[model samples]
Target: MTKKTLAFVVYPGISLLEFVGSRTLLGIILAQEGSPLKLGVDYELVVVGERIEEIPTDTPLSILPQKTFADVARPDALVVIGGGADTLLALEDTNLISYVRGAGECASWVAATSTGSLLLAAAGLLEGRLATTHWAYADRLQAYNVRYQATETSNTVTDGKFTTTAGASGAVDMALHLGAQLTNQATAQFGQLMIEYDPHPPFGRLDWTSFDQQRAILTPLMNRRPDRQDTVQDIAFLLYPGLTVFDLVGPLQVFSALHRIAPEFRLIVVAEQAGPVMTDIGVRMVPNCTFADLPHPDVFFVPGGTTPTLQAMSNPAIRQYIRSAAQHAQWIISVCTGALLLAAVGLLEGREVTTHWSFPRYLKDLGARYVQKRWTVNGNIVSAAGVSAGVDMALYLVSRLRNEETAHTVQWLIQYDPQPPFGGIDYQHLKLLPRCMRGIFTFVAPLYTTKARRLTRQERGRPPYDV
Candidate 1:
């Protein structure tokens, strides 16, 4: 079969989730089996920028552009992504606007999400077209001479060849809609299942019961079904009460994209019970499997939280599970304070590791070198600092599991390039804060650690430290 190309137009400060969500959905369709088409064979993915250089996102990481507008003049589909104020400034680039116009004219599918519609409108592609953008930018859409969608739901409006969605969150909806339009509803459903795109957002209100019913029907169609080839590597994500959602999701999302490229990853969310595990942010993530049900995993990932994580560190069952899982696992990974769990289980002794910046001294107390890096690797153990750094660690693991090129492709698929809005606050800036503000944290930090130690001892049926 002849190959078709899909080009994602990116610029500095583009929303990573918007580009990642869309690319993942479409890539899953290409990864499906029933379809005679295959990614890199029947379909190609190209990340096009003004030039072949690194483009930063709203996060700290940056993506390497695969193609330049000078190279990919036209592709089967061209999606213009969007971001913060930088996206608006990117629209002023005459060459970028010209490229969008040229690509829209020739590409089979022309689409944009969030502020990307602004670029589409600037390119004159959304003229007289029904469209949408970020909810905050809905009023701004009218300034560009396009009909704005006022709804705040996850919906995509497609008028002829021009497709648009509300914001970064709606990109998946737009991608699935496009997938169904390109292939069929069944194929789109297959793609949706591949990425587990069922909407159960933390901050947003969603009918989880209805979503659960839908997943019951869709889970069988997902490539990660239990009955699939036993050789597939099982990557288990540990879920405990009150764990931080982003710490778990950051790496899990990276692995999800890798699954699209190679269906060898079996992602299982395992908890003590197969039910909703409340996160620190009040989001309840339902585990896919129970500790009793999950076999030994190839990769064991642990995410950390506050009181709950501290409490879990002393849970004999959880500690035993981690110890046993780490025994057979080729890679043992942790994010944020999740390293504390490893330390408590006697796994991090004499190893270089990192954790959330606020508590690095604890690692030294636990007999590990506190490396102040995004992520640290020592033999089979991988540790990432803070919340979002898990993305870097996971991508690095993907490189180890497959190859650097495959990891780069996965990174491009997710638009892994990052550029923080306010940027990082250095030690000097932090010291410039009010003395009372510094005193508050300093006074509270040890108290939290002391309370956690007390809770850990109580959970372990041991005497309190001071008592």
Candidate 2:
């Protein structure tokens, strides 16, 4: 069997969510066990950029492309990731446009998400084709002789071989549809379950009645370019293999918006090394700095996952770095089971914290009392409930760090207003799953707890890790 390559084109300032959301879904189909498909066997996923360098995203963290455009001129499929103003800027990049046009011409099918459709239109590929982009940028498609499909009617639009998606979140829907086309329905459904793509937006969908007014509010905010300040506070996010992409990206998107308007706030992703780290969903993310490079950031953030997170708890280097950084950090934050890592490090002992709903017992085993809430703040330590909750908690952090008005602007900028299709999670009916998970954690908890205890003893008499 020949392996088909799926190339995702990435550039500086591209929307991280739009890029990762789709890649994660599709990547999982290849990586997930028992799926019949295997990464590098049945399919290969690669992030393609102009050069194999660190390209910054709309968020603080940057992505490292696995291949250059020159390397993969003809892939099985091509996906162009979109962004805000920078996406508009990308339209003027002739080299990029040429690369996109040339590669897209030879690909089996070409796709774009959000404002990325404009890039396709710019390359003269979408002319006379029906397509969709971010609702905010949909009107611009008419200028290229492309018929626009309303996002209200459909999140993804397919006109012949060209596929386009509505917003950043729309990428997920697009990926699922494409995944099914590439494989089978069952394989795509399995991929969806692997990532837990079940979304429950707290608010319920956007109220389109006020679309014009909402658009008016966001246009100027997107255009504003504040001057960088001399003294900037560093907000560091931890990156590791197998960490949930949304857990890191959700809050990172919130803080990234805050950084745009409030230049004094800087966002950075730190890891054991400065290179590409594979996420749990099979997408690779690049960190800007090493742990030793930025040891004492103002704010230190940890994102959580499943088995890898438990494995991370026992890693001496990761544990020591968190322990050392927390000593001088003004704020320490965690999303999902990230709280478990902090608990393992002895930071959450007797502290009121919250984690993903499935791991309260694990949190308790590590010596922290779990409070069931979207987020909990005890002094400078803040822990959010689960994946999507990070966005809510980060907004609260923005309000605290800057001001209510600033946070409100950031919310509007990201269009954070949630309208889940099926409404919010009903914790009342979610008993059996957590009960089953507890039995599994029962066996897994002691292995890490004992190791954590041993690491703490070894570090007590010594100074912090050199990094």
lDDT of each: 0.69, 0.79
* Off by more than 4 A, model 1: 1-230, 431-467
Model 1 residue 418 CA deviation (Å) reads 1.6
TM-score, one value per model: 0.51, 0.83
- Ten contiguous residues minimizing lDDT sum, candidate 2: 415-424
For candidate 1, write residues 281-391 as lDDT tens digits. 332446777787764789989988666776776786687678678778999999888998887766787999988755565665556788867788998999987665677
Where model 2 places Cα greater than 4 Å from the true spot, the runs are 33-41, 152-154, 180-205, 272-285, 290-293, 328-330, 351-361, 369-374, 385-389, 403-405, 416-442, 457-467
- Candidate 2 lDDT over 1-467, as tens digits, reads 56788889988889887787788778866655555455335767888999988888887677778889999988888999988778888888998999989988888899998888999999999999999877667778779999998766457889989999876557777888788777666677655544444553334345668778878877776867768799989999999888987789988888888877888988888999877898875557788888989989899889898889988988877987898889889999999889988988888989999987667778777778998788899999999887767877888888889887777667667655443222345555544544576577767777777887677666676766657
TM-score of 2: 0.83
